[model samples]
Target: MQNPFSEEQVRQLNEIGKLPPTEQQAKLQAMFSTFNEEQIKFLQNQQKAVQEQGGQCPFCMIVEGKIPSQKIYEDDQVIAVLDINPATRGHTLVMPKKHYALTAQMPDGELAHLFMVVNNLAKHLFETMKAEGTNIFLANGAAAGQRAPHVFVHVIPRYNGDGVNFEWEGKKAEDEELAKIREQILKEGFEIKEEVEEEPEEIIEHEFEMSERIP
Candidate 1:
């Protein structure tokens, strides 16, 4: 697209961008009022292009209902859905409605709520699907085999000879190395203390009864 903003308008927008979030919207509205019809349309298209680029994550699209999902549970902060390409039967995914690439980026309260949803889904599998055991798995980053950009917890129901393998060859670390690793983790934990104010936990009742087999 051609440059839609003149030098003066560009300067004004830069000033607007630096404003506090609460003030920027009113400033932007006032700025937009001065634009001609064609300039306004061009700005609108540019804004839309930016949104499309930023919101293209598949999980975000699913949350927006732009993409269909076999959703079993949904609330203000989280959603649980059956994994279409499941590891085994009743392999469901629980994720935050907001897009977060890593758990580290999420607020402590939201993270707590997200895992609470995961726990309930696990319980639902055990009760409704008669799952003997379940694995609450999360691959946090690309290095950890995370295929999607959005973070999600996988609730995979376990059975005897289910053929899902999360095994790895066990290696014993030296005592000194293990001690050093533990120390590092403890130090990091101390640095990242929870800061979000704890909200009263709300009881959420969800019905997740479904056929054990997907159609």
Candidate 2:
């Protein structure tokens, strides 16, 4: 099949070359390196359109029936669908009902609900598909392999001898830097911590119940 990505995009992919195989990240550095001025402009235009018409966001279009997708699971707050180009057997994507390019942009309650759906799907895939393990992935920016601006989480199933891997080097953190980062996080305030207080325990249980319904 002809590459779905444009020539510039392909060049960009080549520039990045093969990413650390263990990371399982898309070879985006090379892809972006190939993006010409025109392609970059096109992407910018699409993003502007998304911002102007919240209801018309690409992911929202899929969710609102304006666009078509291979759906696996869905509810009021989120949707799980088959990836058009799956990396592994039973690879799926989980997206929020709202259109947010990055997870950081999503409301705490919405992000919580989205992850709740992801957790449920992970359990279902392991039990029904008999997967050995699973990888939950999120890419934030173009540099991070985010092709579409819409925020979606990838739920990739792995089995013994499946050949999929997710290895990355973790940098050692200096004690002073770590302490400074922790202090900053404490000062900025966090939403997840606060939202958990308002949500009832049964709601969490219901999320798990919904997971059991997925095949």
lDDT of each: 0.76, 0.69
TM-scores for all predictions: 0.67, 0.59
Expressed as tens digits, the lDDT of each residue in 1-215 for candidate 1 is: 67778899989988987976445544655565467656665665664465587747688888888889988888778888899999988999999877665575566888987887788778778767887799999976555667775779999999889989999999989999999999987884655565675643443535654233332
Q: Where is model 2 more than 4 Å wrong at Cα?
A: 1-57, 170-215
Candidate 1 Cα outliers beyond 4 Å, as residue runs: 1-51, 183-189, 197-215
List pairs with backbone clashes in candidate 1.
none
Give the number of the best model, judged by TM-score.
Answer: 1
Q: What is the Å distance of residue 44 in model 2 from its true position?
A: 15
TM-score of 1: 0.67
